[model samples]
Target: MEITAEEMKKSIEKIYERLDEVSPVDFDCGKLCGEVCCKDLEGEGELALYLLPGEELMYEESDEFELYYIDSSEIKYPHSWKGQIYLVKCVNPPRCDRSIRPIQCRTFPLIPHITKNGEFHLIFDETEFPYECPIVRDHIKLNHDFLKVTYEIWMKLITNPLVYDLIDMDSRMRDNRKTNYEIVV
Candidate 1:
C-alpha cells in the first residue's frame, strides 16, 4: 500500500516528537567527538545526510542547510525506491536548527537492522565515517529510554514498505559480507 504525502508528513512529525523525548546519553555525546557527524572537516568529503522516503517535507531551502535532490537510479538504493531522493548538508557545521533535524540525525549511533530470519533489531551503526562516533567506537552504554524509544520508532517506521525495503537491503548486504555489528535492541 502506498502512503500519501500527508500521511508521510504526519508520521514524520510523530517520529520527531517521540525521539525528542530521549537521547543516546545523559550528556551531549557530541562533546566527545566534537560533533564530527555534522562537520565537513579538513580533507574529508562534505557531510550530508539523506532524508528517508517523503522526509524532505520537513525542510525548506534555507541558508542553514542546502538540500540536493538526486535521481534514485543514480544511487545504490533499494529497487523499491525511485524518483528523487533528498540529501541535506549543513551549511554551518555543527550548528543548525536542532528541533527540525532529520530522522537520520535523530537516530545516530544506532541503525535499524533486520536479520535473515526476519527479526528486527537496532544495532550500532557500522557505516564508515570520516570521523569515528564515540558512542559506537567506545561502546558507550546508552540510556534505556533512548534505546527503547528508538527501537519503537524504527518498528513503526518499517511499516512503510519503502523503509522496510531499505533496511532489508542493508541487512542482506551485511549478512552477505559477514559484517560485524553489535545488536543493542
Candidate 2:
C-alpha cells in the first residue's frame, strides 16, 4: 500500500470525527427500510464492504469482522490500483457497535465524485446495492451537516493518488453510462 499505517490511522480518525457528528437524517433511516442495506438480500450474494486502500489499518486489532484480501488485478478495479484490498463483512451487522463502524459504513448512501475539472462532490450512491435505501429511493433530504462533512473528508481523502483514481474512474464510468445520480453537493 502506498499509504503508511500511520497515515491511514490519522485519516480514519479525521473521517470518524467528521461523520460522528451527523447521520443521513434526523431519524434512523434503517427504521424505514428495516436496516436493509446492512443485510444480505434474498438472492444476492452475502454483503461485503470493501475497504478503501489503506483502510485495513483501522481494523488491525478488531476481531468482530471477517476480512478477505482480494488482488486488485483479479477484480474490476481502477487501473491505478495494484496489489490487494480488504473486503470486510461484519459478523453481526444489525448489532455491531456503530461507534466503531468502518469508513464504508459511515459513508453509505453518499458516494464521492470528482468532476473532470478536479472538483469534489457527493451524490446518492447509485451502485447496485443488495437492499434498497429509503433515503436514496425516496429522495429524502439528508442532514446538511452530514453532506458538508462527508464532502470535506472525501476532498481530503482524494489527495491520495490511489483514492483519487478510484473515485475518478468510477465517476468517469458513471458519466459514460449516463447514470442519473442526484448531486447532493
Candidate 3:
C-alpha cells in the first residue's frame, strides 16, 4: 500500500495544522476512588481510543503494525486491539505515524463535540482510567507551554472548515448504515 507523496504531504500538513490547535491545557484529573482504571486494566473498547476516518490510511500504508478500526464510522471505535500492553510507565503512545495517527490522537486527552448543524468544539474526556494517565495529572501542569500548544492545536482542528467536508464524506460512506464489525484496514 504505497502512499502517494502528495497524499502523504496532505496528511502531514493537515496533522501539523491540527497539532498547532490542541494545546495541552492543564486541568485536574479526578482522583480514582476505586480500582485504578488505566493502571490495572489499560481499558479496552473503541471509546477508549477512537480514531476518525482517513487516520488509518497512513498506518495501513506504512505497515508498522496491524490494528483495525471497528468500521468506517468516524470516532466510533467499538473495539480496538487490546493485547498485553504494558502500563504504569512514562510511555508515550506508540509513535503515531506522523501522517497516520487519527485526528483524535492529534487532539489527545481532549474530546471533540460537533453540533447537529455541524459546529465543532473541544471538550475534555477525563472520565477514563485517567488517574493512570500521567499527562492528565500532575505530569502535565496548567499553563504549561506544551499543554497550551496542544489545546490550541485541538481547537483549530475542531473548528477548521474542512471538518464539515470530512463529515460529509463520512456521511455518504455511512449511508448503508449497518454496523460494520471489521475495520476498513
Top-scoring candidate (lDDT):
1
Please provide the root mean square deviation of candidate 2 (C-alpha atoms, Å): 1.9
Write the residue-wise lDDT of candidate 3 on 29-123 in tens digits.
Answer: 32422323322245553223434333444444454334454333444322232322211111133333434444555555544444445544444
Q: Write the per-residue lDDT of candidate 1 for residues 20-132, one digit (tens) a residue.
A: 99999999888998887888889887888889887787777467888889999998999889899898888888888887788988988899999999999999998888888
**C-alpha displacement of 150 in model 3, angstroms?**
3.8
How many Å off is the CA of 154 in candidate 3?
A: 3.7
User: Which should have the higher lDDT, number 2 or number 3?
Assistant: 2
lDDT of 3: 0.42
Candidate 2 vs 3: which has more TM-score: 2
Candidate 1 residue 105 Cα shift, in angstroms, is 1.2
TM-score for all models, in order of appearance: 0.95, 0.92, 0.43
lDDT of 2 by residue, 56-174 (tens): 77667767767788898888788888888788787777766676677767877899987778777898897877667888889998888888878887888888888888899989988
Candidate 3 to truth, TM: 0.43
